[model samples]
Each structure stands twice: as C-alpha cells, then as structure tokens.
Target: MRRDPEPLLNIKANAEAPADARPPGERDPYLTHLGERIRSLRATRGMSRKDLARGAGVSERYLANLETGTGNASVLLLRQVAGALDVPLPVVLAEVDGHADPAGQEGQGGHRAAEFSQLVQWLAQLPAGDLARVREAARHALSPSESRDARRRRIALIGLRGAGKSTLGRALAAAEDIPFIELNAAIEQEAGASLSEIHSLYGQAAYRRYEMRALERVLREHDTMVLATPGSLVSEPATFNLLLSRCYTVWVRTSPEEHMARVVAQGDMRPMEGNREAMTDLRRILQARTPLYSRADVSIDTSGQDADSSLRALRAQLPHAD
Candidate 1:
C-alpha cells in the first residue's frame, strides 16, 4: 500500500490560556523545542552562534532568534541550519514532530536531500585549484559601475590556490573597464622576494606581514581595481576581516576533481608531487577555511566552465559590475 507523506504541522501558542498560565518570557513549546535543538547541535559541534551562522550562510541575529524560541524559521532555513550543525535534517524534523529518537521511526531519515547536504559539507572541505575561482566568484557578485562611481566601491577576492582569481579577475576588470592588480605580484615587488622564497626564508608569518602591507598599499592607492589575492589571506583572521570590511568579497569554488584537473592542465604538479596524502590534507585545509570563505558576499561554482561563461554569470549577478 502507498502511504501518504507526513503533513506539515502548524504550531502556535494557545490564545485562550490564562495570562499567568504561561511562564514569563516563555514562548510556544514547539518554537522553544526547535531553539533547544539548534542550541544542542551547535554546542555538540563546539561552534558558537557566530560560527554556526557563518557556516550556514545566515546572519548571527537570525540564528540567535531561532535559538531563543522567538523566530519562526522556515523549513528551508531550518534545513540549512541543521546542515551547518552537521546533523541530519530528519533529526531536526523529528524533534519538531515530538519524536526525540529518530531511530524509532521507519524511513524517517531516508531523505536524500539531507544526505546530499552531508556530501556538500564534505566536498566544501576538499581543496584543489578552485580557491581562486571562489575569489573571482566573490568579485563577480558585487556591483560594477561605470564613470567615477566605480572608483567608490571597493572589492576583494580571497580563496585557495588555483581557484582562478587572477585569470577571472582580469576578465572581470576588462568587462568593467577597471584596472586589475595581482596582489601577490604587488607583494613580491614590495618585499623584493618571490612568494616561494618568502615562505621558505621568512616563513608564513613574515609572508603575511608583506601581504598585509601590499593589501594596505593597494587599498590606499587604488580606489577602484579588481584585486587578485592569495588564498592563504584567509588564514590571518584580523587581516582578512579588515579587507572584508573595506570591500565586497566573493568566493569561487569547484569540485575536487575539477580542481585537480585544472592544476594538471596548467602543468602544476606541486600538489601531486608532495605527500601522497595531499588530497586528504587539502580536504582538511578547505574544511578549516570554509567558514572564512563563507563570509563573502557571493559564491560561484566554476566547475567545468569556461572563463567567459563564468565571468558572464558573475557579471550578471554583480549589481555594480554591470
């Protein structure tokens, strides 16, 4: 026999209850339950509300309300929140249904979309050459203005290696008629050392000092320019936050397989030549950095797409980039 799907329940507080019947500052039980579940999952993952909001692409205020039993989060929002908490969607829905134990319900957790969210979380952690692509995506998400107005809006692209920040950035700049600058090149010129040499001789901390100086110089000198930045900029939270505060940010992304293919096609075998466990390391690095990347204004998936297509797609989305 074909069984009907579960009905969506409307949860509301009783209007007929006596004034004192409800505790002070108490909300509807269902809302309170949802809030508790969100808080529980967040605590279990060792994430603060801010961390959860960033990971889920929602605002911290919204998350706070959801946890405080005051906000009526939609189904889609609940799913995103659940995914960010790394819990199964049904686990959240089950709580809503008054079933604390999901294991007791048959096929309750069989939602493939929830499983797909897990896969996305796993893939989001993988690293490859697509970090630059994410930067380009961020840039493309912003508005492109002509005339002097273009000079007023500041933008920055930050992501991982091989994410195509430079390549796509130039195209975006040309389309918008704005100047394009390679942040790494600017850093090398300012420090008088190549990135590899800086990393090898002075270490990451030294390189970051040079990178920050270069970023400040560019931000001060050029009011309007498409900036191509290194992916590791995100590792320095203070610096990255400063850059983000000064400009609109974008994140370009792609699948691990696509990232590997692009790097191989570019004749860059550094990742492959290193440890055999490079892919695993890449995944861990991306996972650690994804929260930073999610802070961008826009995200684009550049997998299997050409530069023109990616740029055009990004331009369409960018209000000022038009």
Candidate 2:
C-alpha cells in the first residue's frame, strides 16, 4: 500500500511544537535523542560545542541549551546543525536506543537489536566487491518475484543538471505517447513546499526521504512513464538501484562546456556567480560522479546539438526504436 505524505509532514509538525506544550519537568525523548546525537557526532569529529555553534551559525549558548535538552530548536536551526555536523539530518534525528539499559540487562527486543547491530558491523567489514555481491544476494532473496519483472517502457533519464534531461525527456515521452514526470516537481508537490524551502526547513535528509517516497509512489502508480530525475539522484544508492531495476535507465551526456552553456542559456546564472572556479568545480564533480552515472544502461551525448537533434539521437537509443 502507498504510504500517505502525513508521516513526513508529521515529523516537521512534531518538531516544531512548542517546548511548553510538554509538562514542565518532562523531557521530550525526541529532543533528548536529537541533542545526544548531535553531541556524539560532534565529539566523534573532535569538535567542541563552540566549534559546532560557529559552523552551524548558531550561538554557543543556544547550542548548549539544545545539548542539555532545555532548548526547543526550530527546524532551520536543526538543518544548520546537521549541515555543520557533516551528517545527514536523519542521522541527527535518529533515536538513540539501548543507551539507557546497562550491559546484560537486555530483554528479547534488546537481544534482537544486538544481533542486528552485529550483522551490520560484520557487513561493514566486507570488501567493496563482496559487499555488492552480498547486497545483490540479499535483494534477490527478499524481493518479490513480481518486483523483478519491471516494465521496459518505463524510462528514466539521469545526469547532471543542464544535460537536457527535462528537454529530451518530454520530447521522448511525447513521441511515445506516455506521461512525463519530473521527480523533483513530484517531491515538491509531496512536501507542499519548494525544493529550496525543503532544504532550508528540514535539511537534505528530509528531502531525501521525500524523494524516495515520491519515487515509490510514482512507480506504484505509473507502469510506463518517462521520469526525469534530479541531477544528484545518482548519489543515493538505494534510490538509484530501485530506478535501475525498474526503469530503462539512460545517461544524458554532454561536454562540461556545453553543460555550463545550456544552464547560462536558461538564464540561471547561479552556477557561475561569484565563483571563479565554478567550471573547475563542475568538472571535478562530474569526474567524481562519472563512475556512478556510467552504470546507466545507455548513454547519449547531446553536446553541440539542438533539442530536436538531441531528441532524435535519444529516441534512437531507446529500446525498440524504429
């Protein structure tokens, strides 16, 4: 069954509730866990509270209040803290279980939790190649047979921004008489907020959660559609794997120069604003992500080509192109 958007909305709603709403002496488990998680992550990074406060753009006094579980932080503050901690927002928000219980004071639930932790530790030590094999094995072992039989007509285009994904995706879908969906737009609709607002309010982790849910809903609802995903969608392994397994994946390739040119042509100049090394940074990012993007089933370079020309080339690369 498709889960409703209420759960994600509830996270924000619950987080933003006034601290006074609780009894004067009662501690919020959620806030307590969040505070401890932040402190632990900062300690692991060998940072002081002052350091974290500066990084997060908050005052030390406010941070201290949060760590002591005496402050009610706004979502924006938490987002900044998550960014400063160099971890996803979900990690910061994750409840810290088993800490209150002493060693050997565990019930059946605790025992099972320990076993799960041990399994994760064991898996973490495996070689990269072995890990991939283990993942595939586990996936096949657990997945329903029907899930393995995905429709080939469901196409997904993945690449960096300005690679002509949106442009070519619409053309291809129109040519084939199919629905076209932009994954980011779907996420925004699901969240009831813009992408920037999502990041500003809930951080990247929340955005990622919404992204996954939106994708799942789309897949469940549409058996055959063209999905134009966000540029960084490839960075999330689970989401990308689901995409690869279910869709005819395509990497819309273009030269770095052309990528910049297209973005400029679109009148969004934020890429080159105030950064002399913008092109260099873009190249570095592209290089780092190439291996991941290369996992697509097909690739098409649209450099130096008009949208019509690119559309024709992309269409030819699709399955059963006439």
- Each model's RMSD to truth, in Å? 18.9, 13.8
Q: State residue 241's C-alpha deviation in candidate 1, in Å.
A: 1.1
| Candidate 1: residue 260 Cα off by (Å) | 1.8
Q: What's the CA RMSD of model 2 in angstroms?
A: 13.8
Q: What is the per-residue lDDT of model 1 for residues 52-165, given as tens digits with 9 covering 90 to 100?
A: 586677999999889888765345455555767877665565422232245664353444444655655554665755764665555445523233344336556766666777
- Evaluated against the true structure, the overall lDDT of model 1 is 0.67
Off by over 4 Å in 2: 1-103, 107-128, 138-149, 269-272
lDDT of 2 by residue, 67-186 (tens): 777665465356556667755565555443534345657766666555666666577679999997897787555543333235467889999888999999999989999999999999
> What is the clash count for each candidate, in the order shown?
18, 0
> What are the lDDT figures for the candidates, one per model?
0.67, 0.75
Which segments of model 1 are wrong by more than 4 Å? 1-152, 269-272
